[model samples]
Target chain A: MEAQKVLTPSKREQQKEARRNAIINAGYQEFALQGFTATKLDDVAVRAGIGKGTIYLYFDSKETLFQEVIRKNLFPIRDEAQSYAAEFKGTATEHLTSHFRRMYQALHQDRMPELVQLVMGEGLRFPEIADFFFREIISSNQELIQGIIKKGVEDGEFRESFNAEFTQILIAPAMVSALWRLQLEKQSPLDIEAYADAHIEFILRGLKA
Target chain B: MEAQKVLTPSKREQQKEARRNAIINAGYQEFALQGFTATKLDDVAVRAGIGKGTIYLYFDSKETLFQEVIRKNLFPIRDEAQSYAAEFKGTATEHLTSHFRRMYQALHQDRMPELVQLVMGEGLRFPEIADFFFREIISSNQELIQGIIKKGVEDGEFRESFNAEFTQILIAPAMVSALWRLQLEKQSPLDIEAYADAHIEFILRGLKA
Candidate 1:
């Protein structure tokens, strides 16, 4: 144990990298368990097996660490949405539905429920985080939905006067909460993918066809 | 001040009522200003101009006191949703649209945003409240929405294949955040009434005969 614990210059850098990862993992657990208000840097440091000073070497503040946790998790998923939406071409509703199916599947994945709770629960305290979400995640996906709906209407796949932006807003919250709710329950009548399929079907039925 | 402060038994009762009202008002302010975990009963009592014991006479606990504030303000409005929904008779879409319009207005009312914040912020820690809300509010309304959609499909006012339950799920969540976002400096354009109107319209267009 003593031999393995020693670090040279290059090994010190590797140890630093391990400490950074440990801090992030510890922060994620703390944020989830205690929420933002109750969580403390000291607790996180203890969990990470690092000193208060070592924790500072990687991140400046609790807020910054939490922000990075959010960024690390959110941007990749958002990028996934972009790539999925980009690959489709067909009826606007169909194209949009494919993207939603993928997004819904991702959202139904285990980590997302905790993330949703963190965001929805804490977003009120930090209005800026809500802004970040709207700008970086919701608004972009909404625009893509709007574009697809617009194209659908234009191509005579949907009714000519269909309003895409409004539809996105109308459908978004339900879609966001549905999976979260299903997870909250012990046994839902439907799993998330089934719910997503049903949701897309429901939306298609509601939109101007 | 002399006349108001006079303490006959009748006057004593009046003063007690006024003080209780003051306490509840103070509680709401404190809870909203600092959130539940940070808010102290002493601050509430101080703001109310009464002993904390006086607060106990009027309300059983801090949780109860907060619940009372919410119940007093919101229940009447919430109760109206059912009666309003009960009165409508038309095409299924028309009936459902009219029902949601009332709900949109109710959830969008100024009282609801802070109340919603209170629910999400504190309610996560106390899931009993969320459970009560689900039983008292969402469950009944969901049934009504589903019933209408079911009837509409049967009558051919909507597409015969309409997914009744998930459609209601889709109807929620967009307008859910409206009132809370109301006082924010930069709100999403998807507002309560606008989103409701758009949703009702979209659903109609998608399902219309």
Candidate 2:
């Protein structure tokens, strides 16, 4: 009793985080394989090696847990891409192309491509989660690219008239690449690296000062 | 009696076409609103004002009906865009821009934006429909753009390096616009016309000879 009571609050918090992460990992794997509609909360608990009741202690529902899985998996990748752009010492074209490449790479490497399908596939049915994702993921990422475009103009790499909304236009190729890879690639294979390079070339030439 | 007999064949053909069309339209409306998994054939039959058994006469299953709906609605628009590109008597930039504008316009006017959502959302689950779409709509559209790019290069308006596959990259912006308009517009309205113009400007500059 004395030894258990002596454990630090920070240690207790770490345990909670570990348990939470296990649940998230299991949720992502199950959801990716079976999709949003077919997945069950009980299976997630079994996969995580926890009691079904323990899942409720962490997540109110499967949707809530799925949201948490997206948050954990996608946020780090998004943040890393932002930091990579910030830290890069290159021309705006290089910076943007590298950022675009990294987004695709991370998406595939992390096996998060299914997440895109899930959002596009089921988001309409679940408006609140869709709204959360739009605000958090789509909006934030657009802003990041918009900022890069602004910087490119400031550095005299991109033309002054390049509308910031062109960021969306610029990244549109990457979007298609991700979606195609996840949902349509089996039928129509996209050579993603080549595609990305070509996209960068076109976009750079379009924006060149 | 002779007049009635003569009318029977053509009149029966017209009735068959009309019923097929009605089922397609009703399927589009219902599927667009409720999506594929949630939709029921009974509701579709009711909406089309046909016996539920009549639906089976025209379509083998709900999925087949949905596939026909996609084909009838999207194919005409795709063909019209192709025709528009062929008919345009202008510079390559003007031709491409006109085609781009027409795609967005038709997508919105026909209320087919939900189709993007449907394909993105359910395509993975239903591989047959996905494969059909990839082969027909996507591959054909990509080829149409490829032909335009080739013409642009031949006209000394665009560089020769713009490969046929570049067509996919070129059209990514329109894909994003359609998706954003359908899925995220309530939270963040996309001024689609302006977006299309900006896309045209950037793409034209990018492809300059």
Candidate 3:
């Protein structure tokens, strides 16, 4: 009986989420077009069809609104990775192939490339915000990956001699490769996941006993 | 007799080196303090005790001057790595180990921690510049490292299973760990080379056959 009142989201919660989503959509549109520094709250408010005061109620400032937009954009990535963790029941190798494939999909989504540049660019200025994303989104998720490798090692399903700590260096270059192709080589966008899966396979071959 | 004219260090050449050194020193001091964006030629000239126009004689512009600064800063690194490579007489393992250690040491130099931040931070606004450094300085160096590894695999010094591509990944995380320390953890004023050496050792241990 006492739990009933707290179990369900209040109407206020629904209303607040609605307002936040509206603000996030506005923020993304503005950030993508004007770049982050040049973007203004008034522009977001006008785009959202909300008053400037209404935006303030939802977000403390433009920075905070930008942070939420980033957070929301990252949610799909987090959700998919988490879902992969749950659904994966095969060898860690198989799981990794599937897992990395999903990650590349997230990485290559429309506007995701620009979003990466935006995140990295802003990360230089607002490191605290970036740290928040790193801790909540990247490092913690990386721990899940480490757990899979650790399990594989323990079960003797794979080699016992890989350094999980340093694997990010291997994985990251492929992402950097994609960025390079787009930024430097100016190649028509290939399937980044296909490239990532091949890269992961290349590492797996080296790690195999 | 005619060859002597070209062989001798003309007063102009000597003066050029002196001016060039002044510009590099100014670049380091200014880039270290204000980062690339906030840096200006007039300010660097003031710091170097040279007239602004005088600096232009030595360096074409701030961009070219900064590139020269990067090259000058890396000279010791290249020399150290060359010394290590010269000292090694054994098979592939010895060469790869010594070569990597020297590179890591260069990355961990006294002024490098702050300079790396400046490069990564301000490099954001100038994609072409960051790409140039990565290609010419970093990626080309990795190709050298790969050549050593390939020689090892052929000589039976390392496992046939070794992946030169993945092995290349190990070289970079020494710098990434530094980025994590500075950019994320906010641990300022710590010696980064020590941190970098340990990171290199960790990677070497994993990559060792």
Candidate 4:
């Protein structure tokens, strides 16, 4: 038999990182499918193709695993959007249009909608998870959107009355689209692209200075 | 021994109606709390202060009972909204303002938000229930809003491009508010009346001719 090659330290680290990611991805799917309360760690391990105990190496508990899943999958997108907003040099209308375009595109590719549904469905029942989600995702997102709107109002690109408080109203269409895609798509199909276009157009018109 | 008095037919009928109402109310509470799959008929019976068999006497199955609960609690509101729209005489903006005012008031009094949460959370897993909701509530509501939007476009009160298909976007803020109240209320308290006012202002401005 040929001599066995020894693994490098870097190689071992890479393997560990891959295993952690696998657990996170599996956790996302299981949580999306079964919700936070109903999701089982054993099933997540099975889906990840690892021993149940191995999950404990990466995550202390199911709640930690879930928080990690949200952080890994969702926080990066928000960070990217925040950086984009910081660097963006354009009319507020243009900024919002680009923002929504990116959001609609992300909705199609990422599992953000499923996460939103899971939170909306089970969040009240689990206040800790809800608090974490609110503090991390929802609050930051609202701030980002509010920043853009505030800049728009200052620049006379949008109505003076428009402020950060209306951030929820501004983002309402996308939330509706996400929920529709999740729950009512089969019964009443939504053309997300068209819907997104209308949303941008409507908001820009509404916010016109 | 004292002679027993026989009950009148109308009295018997009133008791039957009351019992049916009790079952429907209990079903609503249980479904809201435990969701569609987890709620048990026996538990609902216990809440209703009736035998499990009595539920079957009023309704054939759990699914049927759920349908009745939705129909009894939700349909009248939609019907009233529809009739109001039919007889409404005002600018589209005024009509929409009035509509949303009623909706916000109802959101405080009625259990519509919980039912909406239940449907959004569990409807995908139960397509039959989803279909019923889409058919009975969603489809009709969409039509009502669309009709108002269509009239607005025709009357030159709204932008020429503002048509019926944009109905979902128009009504989205309310949906978001309902969802926020259901899930994120404790973490982030929302002043719903102010939110409703903002929603109306935004939509009307957005649709301005």
Candidate 5:
């Protein structure tokens, strides 16, 4: 009887977790398609194949749902990057090259470019979303790159005068590539791999000790 | 009587030009403040201190007004950049440095960053605006930078192997800086001068033979 009772709750818990994920996946699609302001919770519920109230059970408001969508989709990538940087053992140049390649892969696989577009497009109008994005994504990414640069400088692989704070400059090419894909991909298709290689080569040459 | 007739039409033409400028200026403010979708022509008319019908006399729709806004404000800057590059007399390094400095000045003075934010934020939802922006602003800018890189390479100031087609990387920092100001300036204030200097130094070193 006790085993039955425990198994029943576990089954219920599994159902609940599944429902939550369905809502988030639907939210991602809706937000990506309709943007922040235009996305209706009812539409998300329909997409998720759930009742409208079910979304309320999982997420209190549209803002919270959007936050969860970002958290679910982006936080994993950020965490992976952090751990990857922590355990990386190689010359900084190799690390950066490999890291950028992986980043482009992520951009291709994950719809990260769309998310970046959503944030840049809607962020100023929604300051809270902007703040959350900066805190959750931008700052973490900046820290990861800055750590790599500092380590490179310490190991005498990079110029002593290289300002680690200017990691933005180092990463600007990737951001620009993403923006290009979103804005001008049809009119001007970019060779992203070649672009990535150029960026990596330019930075390494510029920062050589 | 003949002189009066000529003067009358010229005076009317001057008035028409003045009114057109007022409408464009008002459209800029509305678009910047409220974004593209949310901006209404009625509000723009009020802002321009004209009747609602008068805006229609000048602009067929909000899209047309927005296009005019972008063209009037951005085309001048692009034209000046073209002329500056054509007339520039110095090494490529000197020219780029001065060009970047002037670009920054325009970004600060002309509210160009806000316009960039507007286009990036709302461009995807409106494909026509995106297409217009790509044609009017982005292509010209890329061509200008490509021309400079080509000149530098030919003159032996830059590496012979440098790819002028990758001019996007050369100009990415400035775009990133503009975006950073729009998004994260409150959280992290960037010194624009130092940022521009870093960008120029990094690119020069990266491209130098």
Candidate 6:
């Protein structure tokens, strides 16, 4: 009688969300271990301890599931970075440096590196996923950096001639470093901390009023 | 008698070199069209007008043949860029910008972009090729640029505090732009010329004494 009272429509909706979250968590692990091409929904279902039909009910296809993995797991980092930036009170240089350092930490400590490898390596074959990543991740970060640079210019912290459209200039070093660590670090390891510091120094020198 | 004279050891050596070049040229086209994994020696032989056995006679494996393609076709462009820098007399900014512009041209107009994609996309699975690319191509370019930065600082064209070991900072924009062109341009196209100009402007301002 107690169970029946708790199993209302709202309770059923909560259960559905839990099931969806379980599938997404399993999907991320499977994709990381074997990559997108090799992963199977059945394996994902088994890993999640959900029925195959139930997995299908939640996700229409493997591609959809992968998209959710990106949205649910990776997109929140952007939000965190944004919130951290919003709460901070500092010079643009300090803010930029700290933001990038946090990004580096997140990239290394999380599954973000594997996700990056997947996009760079297999992205061409799957254009929709690549587009989604670019829109949700790449351009969003670029816009964030651009805003910081613009604010610096307005406050006379950076040179007035600084062009914000070139935010890619600010973002490239981190992107390259991450890709290097993912693919080529075994043969030619870079000290990423030093690399990031030097990048910050270089950009600050360029932008400093 | 004429045929026998033409079949002398020196003549045979010349013939061998010619055959090797032909095979490499064909191999590059095949790989570019079909990528590294799907490419086969039989097609390379047909393209080169050599028998399949002869392909093995010159190259023990497809990977070896691909490495030679990189060495023969791609390495000389680095030498050309270096020579361009060596002969130039200009400010550090001018030299660096011109050198990068040439690199941009080479990357886009030549086969360098294709080679980059092959290394990034297929490299983890083929450690030998990845190592060869890193040692021969990546580190060499970094060293070349580092030398340029050192020369600039010594001449007092750039700030004395400029860190030269962060050569990757200098190289990243071009590398990222090339990869973007190759992989994501369809969805998010960048005007690379404008992008390169912006990058140069940003770096030169940062470095200018």
Taken over the whole model, the C-alpha lDDT of each candidate is 0.68, 0.80, 0.66, 0.81, 0.83, 0.79
**Per-residue C-alpha lDDT of model 5 across residues A83-118, encoded as one tens digit per residue:** 998899998877877787777777666667777777
List the candidates' TM-scores in order: 0.83, 0.89, 0.71, 0.88, 0.93, 0.82
Of the candidates shown, which would achieve the greatest lDDT relative to the real structure? 5
List A-chain TM-scores for all predictions.
0.80, 0.85, 0.80, 0.89, 0.92, 0.85
Per-residue lDDT tens digits for candidate 4, residues A60-98, read 888889888877887888888889988999988889889
DockQ score of candidate 4? 0.59
Docking class of 6: medium
DockQ of 6: 0.51
The DockQ-derived docking category for candidate 5 is medium
Scored against the true structure, residue A192 in model 2 reaches a CA lDDT of 77
The lDDT ranking, best first, is: 5, 4, 2, 6, 1, 3
Better of 2 and 3 by TM-score: 2
- Ranked by DockQ, top first: 5, 2, 4, 6, 1, 3
Ten consecutive residues with minimal summed lDDT in candidate 6 chain B? B116-125
Best by TM-score: 5
Evaluate residue A185 in candidate 6 and report its C-alpha lDDT on the 0 to 100 scale: 83
Q: What CAPRI-style quality would you assign to candidate 4?
A: medium
- Candidate 1, B1-209: lDDT as tens digits: 66655654466787877887898788877876677777899999998878888888988888988777766666777577777767776877678777767767776665566666666555655666666655665567677878887888788786665456554355555445453364333755545556566766766665665
Give the top-scoring candidate (DockQ): 5
Ten residues in sequence with the least summed lDDT for candidate 1 chain A: A179-188
lDDT (tens digit, per residue) of candidate 6 on B1-209: 77767776576788999999999999988876566766888999999998999998998888889888877877888788767777888766677888888888888876667666666666555678778778877777877777777778888888777677677788888877877887678867789878988888888887777
Poorest lDDT segment (10 consecutive residues) of candidate 6 chain A: A116-125
Task: Summarize candidate 1's per-residue lDDT along A1-209 as a digit string, tens digits.
Answer: 56566644467778877887888888888886677777888999999987877778888877778887777778888897788778876678678677777776676665665666667667546777777777787777777787787787777776655455464544564444643363335322444555666667666666545
* Predicted complexes: DockQ each: 0.40, 0.65, 0.17, 0.59, 0.69, 0.51
lDDT string for model 2 (A1-209, tens) is 66766675467788899899999999998888677877888898899999989888999888899888888887887788777767888777777777777776876675677777777677546878779888878877888778778889999888888778646787777766777887688987888778877887887888889
Misplaced by over 4 Å in model 6 are A2-30, A33-35, A38-62, B1-30, B33-62, B85-91
Model 2's CAPRI class is: medium
